[model samples]
Target: MSQEFESIWDAIEPTVGDALVMKVRFKIMSAIIRECRLWKVSRNIASKRLNIGVLRYDQLLACDIASFNIDELVVLSLKAGLDVRLEVQGA
Candidate 1:
């Protein structure tokens, strides 16, 4: 493999992963919002449940969730009364 190709892959891989994570996080946030409405819990309260600050929660709600890892999202989902499930398909 050429060095240029490897460099491109290195750049693209993380971008692709971040895009995927952002999409998943957006979906998770949608679900969390639904649960919050049903439970009549405010974002501030939800942030506390997730052990994060209200400001951070606001940023997350504003779609700045790329900074959070999958594990953090899983924990947030659980805190929002969601059950996280993982599925893997073999190549």
Candidate 2:
């Protein structure tokens, strides 16, 4: 199994694969963000595609270094890593 799968499974349930989990999380996050009325952004297919892990990390990193999918896996992994910068400062 890929390292991505290791992190992704740990972030979410093993039963729900990374791709599906990413999609579901995106939908939920999108709805929450929409109702917040804070950002004027809408969920795009490209963002979802990025979360799909269609391309290897090396390939993705080579071209667009800013294209990391900050979805559930990344959030959980960062939290696990004790990366306080990723934490909400005040709230």
Highest TM-score: which candidate? 1
- The weakest ten consecutive residues by lDDT in model 2 span 79-88
Where does candidate 1 have its weakest 10-residue lDDT segment?
A: 2-11
- Report the lDDT tens digits of candidate 2 across residue range 1-91: 6356434435556555655555544444443333323323333432343343434323332433234354543443332232322333583
lDDT of 1 by residue, 1-91 (tens): 6445334334555686655665666677777656666766787777787789988877767756556666777777888779877677898
What is each predicted model's overall lDDT from 0 to 1?
0.69, 0.39
How do the predictions measure up, each by TM-score? 0.61, 0.26
Which portions of model 1 show Cα errors greater than 4 Å?
1-19
Model 2 TM-score, 2 decimals = 0.26
Judged by whole-model lDDT over C-alpha atoms, candidate 1 comes out at: 0.69
Off by more than 4 A, model 2: 1-16, 38-91
